[model samples]
Target: MTKDQLKLRSLILTALFAAIIGIMAQLFIPLPLVPITGQTLAIGLAATILGSRYGTISVLLYLAIGAAGVPVFAEFSGGVSKLVGPTGGYLIGYIPTVFIMGLYLEKTSFTIKNAMIANTIGMIITLIFGTAWLKIAANLSWTAAFMTGFMPFIIVGLVKAFLASWIGILTRQRLISAKLLFPERLKEKDNKVA
Candidate 1:
């Protein structure tokens, strides 16, 4: 594929993943501090499939859409208020989460173990940002922030990370086989040690 083709294909995939994140955001159980959401699963899936650059772009696009007042956040919430609201940090946390996950998969061969490791690390980063943000945004104690934002979501996060690792890698493999995500999708930058 030409450079333009590669760029276009990546953009399309990025847009698709952004929509996936938006859709997944709606599938949630609302809570006072933070909603139980599938957004992270979708983020993991996007990172695994699109790799770091495009994955992060996809997440940025998702945030931009939500901040622009589109109803693409949890419980169909959107607008700049939502981005600055109590749960905003969790949303902000996705930046590093998707970037690191995709960067790891890009550098290493994709495997169940590697995928899980990437996703788990990503989740931890999200939790750190989210929990901290919960405390500041909601005016809660650290313990309250942890309990409301981190503790309750631990099991669910693990499950989502596992599911994302398994399903994302499999789906990416299939797409590669089908040629839609070939070439660029499997690219590893040539590194020469001097």
Candidate 2:
């Protein structure tokens, strides 16, 4: 493909992943402070499949849409208010979480093992951001925040991480084989020492 064609494809895929994140956000088991949602899994999938640049772009687009009052957040909520709300930290944290996850895979290899590690790390990052913000935003003690915000999600987060890794690697490989995604060789070259 030409440069413009590649750029267009990346943009399209990025927007599609953003939409996927929004859709996944709706699949939540509600909690008092924060809901456990499929958003994290989608974020992982984006990173694993799209790599750092497009993956992070997808996350940024997702956040921008939520911040613009699009009702794309968990429980069908959205707006700048949601971004600054008690649970907003988790939402905001998605940016770094997806970026780092993608960067890890980009620097290493887009294998299931690497994706799992990256997703696990991403999960921890999200929880930390959420817990810290929960403490401040909800006026809860650190202990309370840990108990409520962090603890409840540990097992569930691990499950999601596993799912993201397994599914993401499989899908990425398929996409590359089908020429829908840029090949892994290209990704390696993109990260080669200069």
**Given candidate 1, what's the lDDT at residue 181?**
74
Backbone clashes in model 2, listed as residue pairs? none
Range of the 10 consecutive residues with the lowest summed lDDT in candidate 1:
185-194
- State each model's CA lDDT, in order: 0.85, 0.87
lDDT of 2 by residue, 1-194 (tens): 78778788778889999999999999999888788998988998998889888999999999999988998898898899988778988988888999999889878878788888999999999999999988988999999999999999999999999999888888877777677777435754332222
TM-score of each: 0.93, 0.94
Output the number of the TM-score-best candidate.
2
lDDT of 1 at 127: 92
Clashing pairs in 1: none
lDDT of 1 at 94: 96
Report the C-alpha displacement of residue 32, candidate 1, in angstroms.
Answer: 2.4
Counted clashes in each candidate structure: 0, 0
